[model samples]
Target: MLALQPVDTVAPAFRPEPVTQEEAAAMFRAALGLFGKWELTDDQAATLLDMPVRTYRRWKAEGPGRISRDGCARLSNLMGIHKALRIIFAEARRGYGWIKAGNDAFAGSSALDVMLGGELTDLMRVRRYLDATRGGW
Candidate 1:
């Protein structure tokens, strides 16, 4: 609250600033880039998109079978990979920072083992086979 000094008292007032079109586009780009860094959380994503969280939430809940066009490239790319991996390992057990399975579909020896265990020998074997076929070995 401000004490009333009365109008025409010869005091300068604070004025709000506005953005031009180019500036607005630049801001949109920056906001979208921020959306890519974090894990998929609705409110956080909305904040990155520069929308009020509740407004974003409402739009999402509408269930129109669509996502907004503002998803940044990094977010899209990571989400695509995550979805693909889920489909590939649908039957695999997940826990302790990795998923492992009987057939080891991902890393071919339980996901956790390959992820944490530096199994270069296993990697080399797979690479060797591919190399032989490609005539690069």
Candidate 2:
């Protein structure tokens, strides 16, 4: 006689921690660094971040205060795009320059041009494009 055992198919529940102000500030700082690498102007960076140029400059000079949920999401997407670029190109300069290089995927427009749309989905679209290009979902 043989006995059959049933395996558990349920996955454990996942609860992510709440985003803190300090963490959001840190992300903003990282985004600023990426902007510098991409050679984005203050106005361009502000537009991409969906913030006013004045606010962006303030944050750059003083510090990032509490970031909204949408703001956090935007920052995350921007960083994800940078990370995927880093993985796709061997040289960091190539990855940084790729943002301004024309691509057929964007109708001959650069990825930076696409992201400059100033919408969260715009940033997400760029991130997804880079992620898929680098064999990520």
Candidate 3:
């Protein structure tokens, strides 16, 4: 009898590809649109984007410009979260409201609360949770 050996299946590190100026702007716009749909306050939006209130206001008014790589990553994760919510929930309202609704996954905290931690990891956590719920993992 021949002995079988186990195969290594470790995935590569997740390094996000560089985004173009237009792609970054488009993602920022999409995230802002989701913010409006979710009825998030200015403070909440600022927190979600990991930006100061003043900077948020400037971006809101002036429109998305050349944002930093971190900003692009944050917006991309938020957009992914929004997309995952829409995919998981049947109703549009439920999808939109889920952000503010308490979730057992976040220790009974709302997804918005977890996102308001003002860190890239917080946003990624919420996005990853939603993706997993949708079986995208």
The Cα RMSD in angstroms, rounded to one decimal, for candidate 1 relative to the true structure is 19.7
The superposed Cα distance between candidate 2 and the true structure at residue 16, in angstroms, equals 2.9
**Span of ten consecutive residues with least summed lDDT in model 1:** 91-100
Error of 2 at 71 (Å): 0.5
lDDT string for model 1 (39-135, tens) is 2366655543335678656655552222333333222332333333434445423311132343334435643233223233433343343344345
Model 1 regions more than 4 Å off: 1-41, 45-51, 63-69, 72-75, 87-137
Worst 10-residue lDDT window for candidate 2 reads 15-24
Task: In angstroms, give how far residue 3 of model 1 lies from its true place.
Answer: 92
> Could you report the Cα RMSD, in angstroms, for every candidate shown?
19.7, 3.8, 6.5
Model 2 regions lying over 4 Å from their true place:
1-9
Cα error of candidate 3 at position 25, Å: 0.6
Ranking by lDDT: 2, 3, 1
Runs of candidate 3 with Cα error greater than 4 angstroms are: 1-16
Residue 87 CA displacement from its true place in model 3, Å: 0.7
- TM-score, each model? 0.26, 0.89, 0.85
Looking at model 3, the pairs that clash are: none
Model 2, CA-based lDDT: 0.92
Task: Summarize candidate 3's per-residue lDDT along 67-110 as a digit string, tens digits.
Answer: 89889889889889988988999898999988999989999999
RMSD of 2: 3.8
Better of 1 and 3 by TM-score: 3
